[model samples]
Target: MKAKLGPAKGKVSDLAQQHGDKIQHGLDRAAKAVDEKTKGKYSDRIQSGTGKAKDAMERLAHQEGTGPGPGAGPDAGGGTPNGPRPPVS
Candidate 1:
């Protein structure tokens, strides 16, 4: 899901969009780990924490400009397109 943000300078929306999914994935894994460690004793707490983590990550990503993008990926001119290109002569 896309997180809304107010107009601000130095925002990194592209990065957020690209990494948000990865961050959420990691959080999910962490939550699962916690649940496993607890032997499913605190399923509710684990789930709640997971949700909070996901929400926080999304908010932070959006605030930092790493949430979803308009197109499939980040927009051009956002940063180094793809990867480092050949050095200009």
Candidate 2:
């Protein structure tokens, strides 16, 4: 059985979709602040992490399920109780 998303997850997914641009702006500002505080010492790493975060947010906002991210979809992962899940083996 597919695991149904809880109310909180549903709300988060809706918020993510609605405020994705604002969220991305916040991420950029945070990354800039961190880079400034480090005086460019960790600029590369900070930028990389920021890019990844933005991509993740975009994906979550676009996910076609009740929640965010990859495993939040009904067909994505095993969340059923006492159900047999396929092992990689």
Candidate 3:
């Protein structure tokens, strides 16, 4: 059966906006695995592709066509997630 793009797109956009950082993290992890499996043969390509994906996610999350809501990203002035560490020694 043919799927409707309208509802799907809206859902995806909402997800992207809500969990953009988490989504980007998963993409980075997948890219790392692929690069490792390829023994660095596709390192450059993988990095480029992962970067593009993160950029697209960011755009979706920060689009704010209707105005600002929650999830203002890192620049919200609250600092990074989980607070800071002990300077990593």
Candidate 4:
């Protein structure tokens, strides 16, 4: 049982790492698109928010081994009982 579980756990870890990278890449691309569409007018704010979102996502990926649990920072608003709410006003 232990021998069989080792490979399965390794595969799951690899998949999670790949998925996390893909998600972060997608977020970067989306941020770039938004900046381009706005002609760089709101570039600073967009980049800031994008950074935060990426961080949150990475944190979530890291927390996967801990079972289902809250995955957001304290300032991430506790209003939503499901998951992290949007970091916007």
Candidate 5:
């Protein structure tokens, strides 16, 4: 399964790199609409999830210095090419 996902990951990463900002804007818009519809009942959870999603997207896109570097390894809590995911901070 992991091997099969490699190509998909690369494709997704490429797409994310090209459309990260648009994707983030869409996420924000969706979260805001959901919050308004729910009367802020789930605002905090929605915001938190959105933040995490954006972070993951950035990582996947290799943006904002998320690419391999100091302090970026299997222990970085970001998924590797074919390694276990560390717990999210």
Candidate 6:
């Protein structure tokens, strides 16, 4: 069970690194669309969920790295070692 998950987690982590920006962008866009459609009724909840999802993605991508990438630290919400965090579409 655990052994099977190890490789799967690794692959997912790799994909996260390869597509982190795109993934984040998609999440942000989806959240924004939902919020707009709901006229802010669920804005807080949407933002909270978005943050968690982005955090998870970052954690997965940076699992083997030294620190939290973007969305963290003094320089969070700016750029990461990989590159500038892409603008939310």
Number of the top lDDT candidate:
6
Which ranges of candidate 1 are over 4 A from the true structure?
A: 1-14, 64-89
* Residue ranges of candidate 2 with Cα displaced over 4 Å: 1-5, 67-89
Residues 1-89, model 1: lDDT tens digits: 23343333225544556688787677778877878888889878777777666555555554443434556464422332233222111
Give lDDT per model, in order. Answer: 0.56, 0.65, 0.64, 0.63, 0.72, 0.74
TM-score of 1: 0.52
Cα displacement (angstroms), candidate 2, residue 62, comes to 0.4
Give the least accurate 10-residue stretch of model 4, judged by summed lDDT.
77-86
The lDDT, on a scale of 0 to 1, for candidate 4 is: 0.63
The Cα error of candidate 1 at residue 46, in Å, is: 0.8
Q: Which candidate ranks first by TM-score, i.e. highest? A: 6
Q: Write the per-residue lDDT of candidate 2 for residues 61-82, one digit (tens) a residue.
A: 6654554465555665222233
> Which segments of model 3 are wrong by more than 4 Å?
1-7, 64-89
- What TM-score number comes out for model 4? 0.54
In candidate 5, which residue pairs get closer than 3 Å at backbone N, Cα or C atoms, i.e. clash?
A: none
lDDT of 5 by residue, 1-89 (tens): 87777677778878988998899888888888888898889877888788778778877887333234676667563542544333212
TM-score of each: 0.52, 0.65, 0.60, 0.54, 0.68, 0.71
lDDT for 51 (candidate 6): 76
Q: Which sections of candidate 4 miss by over 4 Å? A: 1-16, 67-89
Per-candidate Cα RMSD to the true structure, in Å, reads 12.8, 12.0, 8.9, 9.7, 8.5, 7.4
Better TM-score candidate (3, 6)? 6
Estimate, for each residue in 1-89, the C-alpha lDDT of model 6 and write its tens digit: 87767777778888998999899989999998998899889887888788778877987886643334556766443223543333333
Candidates 1 and 6 compared by lDDT, better number: 6
Per-residue alpha-carbon lDDT of model 4 for 23-70, expressed as tens digits?
767788888888888988998799788867766665554544423347
